[model samples]
Target: MDIAARSPIGTRLNGLAAALGDGLRTHGHWVRAAQWVVVLVYSVLIVVPAVLPLPDETAHVFTHLTVFSQFVFWGIWWPFVLLSMVLVGRVWCGVLCPEGALSEWVSGKGRNHAIPRWVRWGGWPFVAFVGTTVYGQMVSVYQYPKAVLLVLGGSTVAAMAIGYWYGREKRVWCKYLCPVNGVFNLMSKLAPLHYKVDADAWRASYGPQSALQNTPPCPANGAPNTARTVRIQPVNCAPLVAMRKMEGASDCHMCGRCSGHRDAIALTVRSPNTEVVALGGHLATGWQTLLILVGLLGIAIGAFQWTVNPHFGEAKQWLAEWLIDREVMWPFAENAPWWLLTNYPAQRDVFSWLDGGLLVTYILGMGLVMGVGLALPLAGATRLLGPWHTQRFYHLSQALIPLAGCGIFLGLSALTVNLLKHEGVPVYWVGDMRLLLLVGANLWTLALAQGVCQRYATSRSRRWLAQAALLPALALVNYQWALMFWIW
Candidate 1:
């Protein structure tokens, strides 16, 4: 018998080990389940829609042309922008993002890549800093119509290309460049949910008695079952391993990857202590709930425009009447030539404000609200949901912020669609790119909201799987709304 040859006994043992890795392993189950969902949805919704065109070619043509032209020429107001900002300070990223879920599931097979201690500590502050600055300028650009189209349209193509080419390291577009991501991150403070670890449990799980404890090794590579490990810095090891270390590093995506190995679990707290235990899980605030509400509303409105009203004839007529009958009338007599009144200052002001500032003002104002308001709310819609403990006020506020924001935007969008439709203005994608940005931003909020809600109910492992499922679902919804005109 050759030693290298796998005989019956050897083959059996190998098969058993593989089975253990696939079946017994928590990560394996989560990843496989998520993958299955992705495959199912991709086939049912995405591929099917593309192959079988919608009956309304005129509408469908407008939709495709809209998406394409927006990507090329216009493209604006997407939900992910708000969601990215919201996730930055909230639980949305860990709870909602499909990519994060996929990464967590796949990470099970690979060793946890511990970012160098320095990088985890203070080295990567520039990532957030640069992201903030870029977002600020982008928000300003959205105020100008032409600038909105050019910048947003160009960025979308660039983001996809970058994601395909160089997304592995730096997560360049998702982590740093994409305006949508930036919005979630910025608005994260507004989210009501967070992933928090039990300090005591975290410490005990990753402590010296690795084999004896129920918890597995630290997923982020803390070297639990080691003896000859060298600690360069006091905070080099996980907080449990190194008592001096307090909270886990900020770069932690809070995917529950550490806990998914059955080593840790997510704990919800109304008022988390500021002590900051290193081995503990991530914390999400209530801000995300509000963000989600806002997002859903935005989606409803955006979809309505895509589906119900493809043109803005009514909007143009109303604007013209408002300008000609209301403002332009004062300048010229009833019998006077129309041209005399058409060139009036009031007319120019209306044109400049609407043509130039309308989209930009809305985008910038909304961005500011998402970024700042997410953090500002400590109290929220109480009567609407029902009064509760004062301690829960902060948490409640987080949930409402996104919801209210979504409603406001959605309402505005409906009005805009109706008004524009009445005015003879064709609702082309280039012109509606700003709305696209709004849609993307809101959808992201909804996903994050789902994650936050899930965190409150589900286990770490299950939540990870949920996150994986959300992304493809979003893509499906987007494709349907765009191609089939099923906005609802």
Candidate 2:
């Protein structure tokens, strides 16, 4: 009574913290019910319409967007989801992904074995991402429901199967092999808030078995029953992320399973660049750098850009002329089938062998061009910054996330802009919009690069020199983007 009376404010603060932590972790039946409702709605809206035939022109409210499914999936859903990852750190993955939920539900019914060794490889995420990306493009997954079923639906089935076989009541499929897993991991590092633990307090409250009753079970899924000398790992971490060593948001699914374990952890706010500027050196890899700089920035640019790119047209025309002189028919033959290209004859459109070849050339050429453009400068930065190594280079290269992310966003947004324009909505300011986005991305990248040099370089001169080395590559990326968005 004496202690309580003496420190009423402190006691109230402790009580408040406990309530906040509990609230953060709680996922009531209504929440689960809402998620199930979303899952059902997604299945109807996304998968069902993909199987239904493409709608007539009058059915299309937003011009050539053509179908409600396509419009909602691409026009509204994907663009905003990507933006949400930057702003909210994968709340979509943690809370609403139908595939993720299905996989977990199935795993609850299956063998519940430990994840295998091969599944734990770091490279699988990137490989899965590239495969998904390439396959989506090959099948024109966005425009066709059958393709969507084959691509997105098929992946969902695979995820459930993986969950059933590989882990106990967990999301092994997502943590290990989901195609967008790596992209999400990289993007999540830019999130503005995350649950952070105070290890000391956690250890104190749960240091022994006798303390168990005093420390309530987390009450979340797989919540700890009674605190004891805490194990080396968190018991309920579904994504299998090690809690103690979690300094960044990259591996966190933010499931809140660990919340209020010892009254030690809480949601905290920080800058989006917190991880990129601090722990990136250790987390970055050459593959990720290449994926961002070339795969996303280059090949993807061409994938999105080719339709509007006159250079692609000239190249295709030149090839057509050459083939005509020789009288070749293979280019005109739709021999490869619909799965390999856009071959919807009912729509009065199909991609011939020539179109497919040209697309491959465009994507590869852009990758080569933009990759070399960025790589040579990074090589130069490595030489100037010293202690040259691929890992070091890769780590330093991550400073481009801001620029790369912006490029990807703008590319996706072009689909939105195109649809709106076709619907007869005025979009005269799109060029200016692209310009603003590009400029913002460039500045953000430059600022991050300067931060990288400051944190990693040995001296002030080296920092400036490293930044100097980065400018040429950044300038080239911006120049090319300008060419795509404005000059061309």
Best by lDDT: 2
Highest TM-score, which number?
2
Give the per-residue Cα lDDT of candidate 1 at 368.
Answer: 44
Candidate 1 local lDDT, 339-401, one digit each (tens): 211112322322333322333343334344443433333222222223433433333333333
CA displacement after TM-score superposition, residue 453 of candidate 2 (Å): 0.4
Candidate 1, lDDT over the whole model? 0.36
In candidate 1, position 409 carries an lDDT of: 39
Off by over 4 Å in 2: 1-24, 62-66, 208-235, 324-328
Work out candidate 2's RMSD over C-alphas. 6.0
Residue-pair clashes, model 2: 1
Error of 2 at 128 (Å): 2.6
Cα deviation at 3, candidate 1, in Å, is 57
